[model samples]
Target: MSDWPPHPEAAAVPSLSDLLERYATLRDTILSLENEKNELGELIKAALLRGERAETELYRSSVRVQKRLEYPLERFREVFGDAAALEAASIDRKKAEALARAGDLDPERLREIALVKEIQALVLTPKGS
Candidate 1:
């Protein structure tokens, strides 16, 4: 990154190729750091798993134990009955869109009621793949 910002006073702006190369390098570094961080996190959790605590000059860390229960829905229904939970949505959105486009479902109604979202993405693929 010695040439980072690419000398703003220079006559030439950075090419897209140069910008992409820098972006890829930074992304790889971030991924490597993330992997190392995750490994250290596992070690910390293992140490704290025995109801232990650890501290450094700047920080103290401890793990809190929690219990969660899991059971079959039928078991729950038998114990509590059906009224506790209600069916929410059954619509398959893609099918609904296809029907709307084919003039089965109302297109105007879909447009009026559908949630709209728009996003921009920059994607980089491996050169040979």
Candidate 2:
């Protein structure tokens, strides 16, 4: 007898049922962990708001809150003229895409302006449910 156990060919290939079961298990695990994380985040936020800090063997955590100033576009435009508001604002993607489609602008120019990424996902559903 060899030191290593013999591998069965059947064990090498996973069935669709096995894959689906594993997928479901992982999905449930991810959802449960996400819920726990959200709950912890809310607790952290509450503690921080109450001027509390937490120090553990593994980590030290504190919150620093800051104020941000926001300008309402239409109201701002009404107050400061459209040209000035447009100069202050960032590029509008929809208008840029339209211009690119119309050949009024070079698509190559967008390489520096935007970073495009592709995403793929597998969606599983129960039969007739």
Candidate 3:
């Protein structure tokens, strides 16, 4: 084959004006894509910020509900006087003893114990950490 570049017509075909026009068109296309990329980046940033705010709000709401329940739980203990509390304890002891008497363990008592263990796990967790 002959030399690939610098054919005589190659230098003569595109005038300076035509080359400048092509450069301008490519520059405008690049700038438009840049603007679109910037807009998309800004949108992504705003969405991430909003998601963080929503997570914070959800945590705050959960704390509020937990705080609201505290008073009622205390009131329930107060309303059920000491005598009733002792009676309930006695009944529980009797039930436990009865379960021991039986050959098989009480599944209900086991379930209650498991539930209490789970609840205590939640209760002892440090706040805001």
Best candidate, TM-score-wise? 1
The residue-by-residue lDDT of candidate 1 on 1-129, one tens digit each, is 376866778988889998999999989999999999878877777777666677665566655454322323453334334542122112334544565577655556545445443332212234344
Report the Cα RMSD per candidate: 16.1, 15.3, 26.6
Candidate 3 TM-score, C-alpha based: 0.31
Q: CA lDDT of 119 in candidate 2?
A: 28
Encode model 3's per-residue lDDT on 1-129: one tens digit a residue. 734234777756767787788779879999999999768545644554455322342232111112211112232225444553343343354443344357334445433432121111111123365
Kindly indicate the candidate among 2 and 3 with the higher TM-score.
2
Output the worst ten-in-a-row residue range by lDDT, candidate 1: 83-92
List lDDT for all candidates, in order.
Answer: 0.56, 0.56, 0.44
Q: What is the TM-score of each candidate against the true structure?
A: 0.45, 0.43, 0.31
Question: In model 3, what lDDT does residue 11 have?
Answer: 52
In order of listing, the candidates' clash counts read 0, 0, 0
How high is the lDDT of residue 110 in model 3? 34
